[model samples]
Target: MNVINKLKETAVSVFPVMVIVLLLGLTVVPLDKYLLIRFVFGGILLILGLTIFLVGIDLGIQPMGERCGAELTRKRSLSLLLICAFVIGFIVTAAEPDIQVFGSQVRGLFSFVNKNVFTFVIAAGVGIFITIGLLRTVLNISIKWVLFILYAILFGVMIFCPQSFIGIAFDSGGATTGPMTVPFIMALGLGVSSVRSDDENSFGLTGICSIGPIMAVLLYSLYLKSQGNFDSSSVVQISETAEAVAAGSPLSQIFGPFEEISGEVLRDSVISIMPLFGLFILFQAFLLKMTARQVAKIVIGFIYSFIGLTVFLIGVHGGFSQVGSELGFALGSKALSNGGIWFVLLIAVGLVFGAVIVCAEPAVWVLSEQVESVSGGTITRKLLLVFLAIGTAIAICLALIRSVAGFDLKWILIPGYGLSMLLMIFCPSMFSGIAFDSGGVASGPLTSTFVLSFTLGAACVGANGNDSFGVIALVAMMPLIAIQIMGIMFKLKQKKGGQK
Candidate 1:
């Protein structure tokens, strides 16, 4: 493969995020030697770590995912398929880098709440949901009717959830359904469709998969409820007062399974990889029925992916994540900052993120290409990317605004999803599927970690905003609006047979 091309893709994925950090730094951080050196070195490490990650995903994780998916599909019975789907979704989601990032972030506030259990449960929830999602797509069910009922049940569950956890649960939904899950889940949909009797049933896997975590987390919150008082002031602190605020960099804070102690980082590393490796063995032995040789090669690939990921995680947790939190916190802390600065920053970062998302998201591009080809180029990549870019920009702006105004995320989410669900009733069958799937794909890996962090920092710190937990939900929501709205436009054009 072209190493240069690979690097460019990684850079694109990292660049918009880096730009946001630099912008925030200029506005808030002093241009002294210490700050300058810190930013420069942090920037370099983040880029390098991202490069390693992209290479790993391409080399190992993606292939293993595809293999697992293909193997899982060979089973024909519904119960067998559901069982396979749950296992695959659970394991793969368990390994997802983005979800793990969010869990660690939450540990900043909820001291006793285990990040590991949260990750595993969410992954299992997604797996179970995806199994149900696959069944819906295959059976050709109405997307809206299902979501309407499920969300209603989900909201009812939320009534009993701890208020502190309500946001965490909603946020977990967006965090878990990311780049790693997208391609493999989409592939699973395709594999199942290939063996099924209908073509329309294979699409729209995202609609169902996207909502699974929402319900799961909301339900899980009930368990956390009896722990008493959801919003414990001691566990988390909020401040608008002028103080020299600083949190140590993520890398230096935690070293790995054995970084600081009796090789604790080594233990952590094994803990991190075990679910994945264990699932790999299970798939090879009972699921795939493949010979030792094939499984060995996949294992080799996973190792490279693992190394790249380890470096990447160390880099983000140590470097970029800290930079992101501080930048927003600093900027938000500044009451003297101009609205013009916020507006300009929002538009600029939004556009950059939109462009970067269009090209660097291999999974999104791959899925888009398939749609265009399947429809005999009736759906052009140019059109798909352009609309997706436009949607991404809008989403980013809304997220930034949430930071500035301290808007309740549900205000955006409720209306945005309501509109998306409404459009499902009118848009073309295929476009509806593609549009809903686009929501999950648009947020992807890059946005979940970096963009979401940037928003959280600015809202929580820069603006001294407390209600900033729902940026991911908004990020996930905006794409639904843009894509579905565009789908309506496309439906109009298709009716006129314009340029087709």
Candidate 2:
């Protein structure tokens, strides 16, 4: 059953890209003889790996989140629970493979920055936001106030930071809350919500969990500006290699200069994960007094998560990153040759990415289901999916325009966020929660790996290096604007009906 579910997930995730490739037809493209082999093999590997990962997550991470959440509530001690929140936030984020992926890619873009420094900074940022999220949950804080404060700080930092760093900072914000962080954080939220008195309180955990990474990335942008080569610009290579260049096969690439460092990351992740496991075990044994079966199941799930995450990281670092960078560079180079060509290319790629995201985004299916359930059939999965596709397509269009036209990303984001916030003021609290949450969930792996690559590629060709960095950030930002617009509509609907 577990394997089957994962297979379904992988098929759902990878099918659109496969169809696109099939439609493109290998005969038309001019590339290496190994191109089809590389893509097919890579696709199969990803499907299996992601399948294995989801299964592992089902068996492990989810339970850990639930156990910890329940245990935190059981403790009934606010101080201890808050401390757990901080440690949990920091550890899980520190273990995040996505952060490392972004770090590696960003480091390659500029000669002056070190990957390790960037990785640590992004992780630290997650840690900070994780703490803030937990506090918000406890205090029952409105989402808008916190976002305003966070973005205000981000804007202030942008003023002092190198212009190049601003985009990277926002991009970092988007990446940090990816597949790894989302599941754990959402599960933790579910765990925390288990004890809540109200449905709204319990249900919005995933929504709140989304914001931490964005704020963290923005904060890190400040550091990138202060140290390192803020003045330097990365070359708009004719083709941007996907995040990592993947000079060779997985074994060769993973075992190279990274061999020494790989061990450290592995060790750190293990050390961090252990305490959480141990805590769960302790809670289960002492307080919950679970039978052997529950303990056994939780333990199995934990092991599964550990292994899946390891494989996921290996795949990401081994080749996926470079592929993203290379593909982006190529697309950007090709698209910018002429205005007519650029517009066509932008719309075409936008369609590809929009379709790809609906299937490949880990969070999209989850969010679709959430919407369906939350709206009690008013928002069917199909309806939610269609709207998301349309809205995301628009966002991609804007992002591409920013890339191709060299428009300030802030122009789009500032107004978009402003409108989202304004909606929050009048929208039903539930819609506001969902709107904020959608911001994080929309820009998942598909966005980071491909859509982001396409935007960066075009931006690098179309604008300055500083501008190239913000495409993903904008991709992450506009969804907040879009979903909230829907939220306002939904709130107004209730008001018209005279519902409480």
Q: Which candidate leads the pack in TM-score?
A: 2
How displaced is residue 90 in candidate 1, in Å? 2.8
Tens-place lDDT per residue, model 1, 1-500, is 46577566567656665565565566545432334344455445555654554555555555555566555555656777788788878876777766766788677677766888878878878887888787775566776666667767776776676666766777787777654467567766766665554556656776678778778777666776666535556366544322232446654433321133224323444555566667667767777676678666667756655555455444444444445555555554453266666556554664565555444454565567557755778888767777777777777677766677664555776677678778778777777777767767776555665566656666665443665466666666666666677778877877788766
Give candidate 2's error at residue 94 in angstroms: 1.3
Residues 1-500 of candidate 2 have per-residue lDDT tens digits of 45786587667767676556534434322333233334444555556666665665666666667667777776788787777677666665565666666777677666667787667666666666666666676677765677667666666656665555566777776676666567667666666666664335444444444455555555565565556545535432333333332477755444452453457646644654575576576667666577688778777866765665454444433334344444445555666665576467656766666656645565665556556654677757665555566667777787777766676666877777677667667766665656566666677765776567656655666664444576666666666666666767765776888964
Candidate 1 residue 1 Cα shift, in angstroms, is: 5.7
Q: What is the lDDT of residue 333 in candidate 1?
A: 46
Where's the lowest-lDDT run of ten residues in candidate 1? Answer: 253-262
Segments of candidate 1 deviating more than 4 angstroms: 1-4, 12-71, 95-101, 104-120, 159-163, 197-199, 223-228, 231-235, 239-277, 287-297, 334-385, 461-464, 498-500
Best by lDDT: 1
For residue 10, give model 1's deviation from the true position in Å.
3.8
**TM-score of model 1 (CA atoms):** 0.78
